[model samples]
Target: MSNITVCSHPIIQQKISSLRSTSNTARDVRELVDSITRLMLHTVTADLELTPTAQEQTSPVAAYTGLEISTKLALIPILRSGLAMLNAASDLLHTAEIRHLGLFREETTLQPVEYYNKLPRTCSVDQCLVLDPMIATGGTAEAAIQILQHWGVKRIKFVAICVSRRGIDVLAAKYPDVEFFVGVIDEVLDRRGFVSPGIGDCGDRLNNTA
Candidate 1:
């Protein structure tokens, strides 16, 4: 079964609420997204394995044992909305590689169209975290995941600010082995394939184009 973690952190909830408001400026949206991504990542990476250092580390005044992340990680942010969360994810996972996957939804079909890919020919990381602000119809997310899977990624976790029920259901059913960490799940998707009460074209909002 797919593991879905809906963030319940008070700060995350408040930020999501702020994001949903129509009055927020593009700056407000970007700041809020940065904050939310940092907070949510704490929960998303909590279970990552750690390994003790080969030798004790010396502090300013004393020596102490230290541990480091044992698993290698890669951040795959689906552009251009996914780029909004990239800095926050990078700040948290300082050593992780950053890759970009560009996908867009066709207006008529609501299917994903890929125009850019930066993944290596062979997988180099132990786990991959896909970043996208919203998952409405799930087409884009599914397409991004397919690319990663095809590149030989064995573990993938999707991180999103919000998701629609239809989106999550589609992804969960199709990629049961993958995990999801999202701020909230809205129950509706309008006929136009937009999540009801969602942040509304996060790419446009982030770029102040909407």
Candidate 2:
């Protein structure tokens, strides 16, 4: 729990509330998700290594140093629904590289199954952010963190629009160093392994498969 930070910014809170509405259309849900993701990235990455970068430039009036971000950043968005956050995050951190991971859950076992993995053989980011719309069981998150670790990433953070307390505990017990930036924490999972009081199947809604 020490590593978890639930954003309380008013705009983030409002968008999250709108995002979870069952009556929301596909476009509305995607827009809300992207909006919250951008806001969350801004709020959470405020303290990232600035590096105090400056480049000398000749201005019309005088010579001055222009500032820039030198920290190496990467994003790993867990497939389909997670892809919704990728563009927003990219817009926030324009220099950050992106990687994709695909995992689907087994309805019967209620566990994650990795169907696609395209992580680079070597990653050189100072920090990596993993994006997922919902974390219900944490199995998918566990896999993502372990993969990043195996690739020699030093710092990793998991960001989600909604998380279940059970899922948070599961990830906390295993990877205390990995931070979590979440919009809201729902209580528990429903009978079907989905988070209770959650916006129904984010992937389905976003892709209009429902």
Candidate 3:
């Protein structure tokens, strides 16, 4: 029962709409993605735990206590395209531990292969955010979630720019507790395993390969 959330924010809608057209250059795509990622993260991080602490001496007007996030956050951005979302996610959670996981799909089988992993030494956290721009086949997201589950993360959230019905089905069946937030559900997948009406291959667009 993966908790799925589709962003209805107008700002997100407008930003991502610019991404649908392939005419945009790599820099344009990256900017649009960063803006959309920040918008999506607002919803994903809403439930983060907080703790209040007393301040000894702070404001010039008066002294007061303040509340700060209590949860330890980890940002696991699947390699290549996920890297595009890192800057936005970092701005949202400045204190979070960032890890890089490199996974590429086997072109013939549509399976994910882990080529690199650099998780934090502790390998544990109160919350984890998995970032990937496209959710076409869902193999990569599932693999990353499994890794976080084994590391003892109590809460996990998956964020993407846009989703497909097929992709949502894969996670909803297996991850009832994980939260899924995407800018939109495109409702189709191409034969080559790409989300239809998507931003195209985000990695290729950002890295200028395509």
Candidate 4:
């Protein structure tokens, strides 16, 4: 599980607790999700490569070397629910290309069904970050990762608010080279495949669809 990073920041924990409440309005849920994603961005991007550039500039009093991220990046947010986390990621990686991958879980099968994909014919980014609010059964996540890999993304990472133990295990076993950054991991999935004690139906909560 070395590739998995579970954030334990108190503020993130507090926000996750609030987000799980049934009492929050759609507005409240959206705000909490945004805040949590923003807080987690630092840890997710901590290892990005930086390179010195000749574009150095002088500050008010002193000259300083300019450094910039060298890796070409892309943000692939699974549609609908994943859109909730897009803003925070885009704010941090302002130049990253944005792509949408739409997938939904089949109620009876608990399997992922892909409905939309916006990737180009050939991969152009060095690293890709998959943004989704929850990893429930791992089916959807697995499908998403496979699509990205098929598209030729070499370095991939998944960022989410919550994940299930089962989901993490499934992904780790299949994609050992991939990385996961999540706020918390619940112990199990409910009978219907939702994460136990997880942020309930994130898309519904974010959009008041439920």
Error of 4 at 78 (Å): 0.5
Cα lDDT tens digits for candidate 3, 1-210: 348888889999998888888789999999998999988888888888888775665788987778788889889899999999999999879999898889988889999998998775565578888999988899988888888887778888889988888988788778989989889998889899988887788889988899
Candidate 2 per-residue lDDT, tens place, 84-184, comes to 99999999888999988888888899778888888779887899999999999888889888888999999998999899989888898789899999999
Q: Select the stronger candidate by lDDT from 2 and 4.
A: 4
Model 4 lDDT, residue 115, Cα: 97
Clashes of 3: 1
TM-score of each: 0.97, 0.94, 0.94, 0.97
Candidate 4 residues lying further than 4 Å off, grouped into runs, are: none
Q: Each model's number of backbone clashes?
A: 0, 0, 1, 0
Best by TM-score: 4
Candidate 4 vs. true structure, TM-score: 0.97
On lDDT, who's better, 1 or 3?
Answer: 1
Candidate 4 clash total?
A: 0
User: Worst ten-residue run, lDDT, model 1?
Assistant: 1-10
Whole-model lDDT values for every prediction = 0.93, 0.87, 0.87, 0.93
